[model samples]
Target: MLFENQRVTPSVSGAGEFMKAALEGAEAIVLAQSSMEELVKVHKICRRRPGMKLLLHLDSMKGLSKTPEAVSFLAGYIKPDALITSSPQAAVEARRHGITSVLRCFAFDEESIDSSLKLIERANPDYVQVVPGVIPVTIRLMRAKTGLPVLAGGLVRTDADVCRAEKAGATGITSSCPDLWQAAYVSRAKRS
Candidate 1:
């Protein structure tokens, strides 16, 4: 339940996007495609919205070393609630620092899926994020193989895509589209 009851977590790269998502009622957000310099501004925005959960995507971040010390710094200083990374070492380090770790895997074909499963076993992360999440079969396969909550990301442009991912057993979906964010909140409100 990393995102709690929210099914869609906005993937944002800047302070503006973060603020907009927060205003749009996002409970959690993945900070991706961002730089080290932007952390301060994002952290300031986060402090204003203490209830929001922040996740830093290590691979997508610029000028941040993918090392244990870097993970420690992020956990201690930046204070993100979770860490998303493609590196097993980074994921392990995040867990060592008592931060939630999400292992990001790109599943383009059967070979990639098999390899990703092996990586997941070794990383032992808190969650697994499968890229190009439109593939329901891959989502189901990853969930079944890992026995961990799976987050579907990338190419999830429409509500139908979100529905497909959820029906396929995805615990949550991450998207950069603002329209999708509003749609998800509206859908959640309707359900409530």
Candidate 2:
């Protein structure tokens, strides 16, 4: 329910305006496309923000140990509200540590769809994000199969995409497009 109202969790891609926009909009922010060196700095700054929920995109970060140990380390060190990862094992590890896990899935073809479905059943993440978020039918199918809240992400270019995702049973939608963070889009997402 919290996610339903707060649909736009700005995915910060770099320093400067993207990070500032992420912090400025919505209640939660996703630290994505960041380097390992930037993690501590981002965590330190975000930790100081009152009432802000931080979700780290583990898969996007570079120069980090790509293992469950890294997930454990991040949970203990950064203390993020949640973690978004493509790794099912990392999701499980995060869940074990009592942190919310968002398992990201890409459905580009049949094989990818089957694999994603299998992982969804296996991981049982708190939330599932389907990449290139335009596929409403796939989103519906994933929701039916997983029985979990879905957050559609990637390739969301307009308000219509947000509306389509919401109508297709997505619990929320995430986009890097700063224009989508405008009041018009937020109201449209809410109204839908």
Candidate 3:
């Protein structure tokens, strides 16, 4: 897995201590709920910190349109490693522009799971991020159905949760919890 070593990609709400902690041993970071007004600052931050992949959450990026042109603008100007969104249109556009696309799906029930799978098929995203990632069964089901790598996120507060998500076949875990961010990189031998 591309993200196996850096298992816990931190979802940042802003540029602060949490962001700094998240960058420690992490290969990627998700700019969670970033607004359009902050694009310049965010780009600068990611630029200064090379080697760490930056992912922008499109759904939460206020003023950003869900169009192919928008995706092109982001790719050409923002320069993020990837883009995450619940919109299938955005996912397609991201792929069209050669930026890695991640489909963010919420699986609360069987109906939602079915819908999410359909969306995944249509978008053909490079990866899928499942919210409320504690459900190991759902994680397995999603992986089997979509055949896309899963990045388990939401409510992942402990190291045990991280291990559980990985054991269930998640390529990696995403969390805003600083402590878990550090713990996710601990050597298995040391953890044991």
**Model 3 lDDT tens row, 45-76:** 76777765777887777788767778889988
Worst 10 residues of 1 by lDDT: 183-192
Question: What ranges in model 2 sit over 4 Å off?
Answer: 183-192
Segments of candidate 3 deviating more than 4 angstroms: 17-19, 183-192
Which candidate, 1 or 2, has the higher TM-score?
A: 1
Ranking by TM-score: 1, 2, 3
Clashes of each: 0, 0, 0
TM for every model, in the order presented, reads 0.94, 0.89, 0.88
lDDT per residue for candidate 1 within 1-192, as digits (tens), equals: 565467688899988888888777887888999988777788888798767788898888898977888998998898888999988999999999889999999998999999999899989999999998899999999999899999899999887888898899888888888887774442355432
Question: lDDT: which is higher, 1 or 3?
Answer: 1
Clashing pairs in 2: none
lDDT of 3: 0.78
Global Cα RMSD, each model: 1.6, 2.2, 2.3
- Candidate 1 colliding pairs, count: 0
At residue 33, candidate 2 shows an lDDT of 86
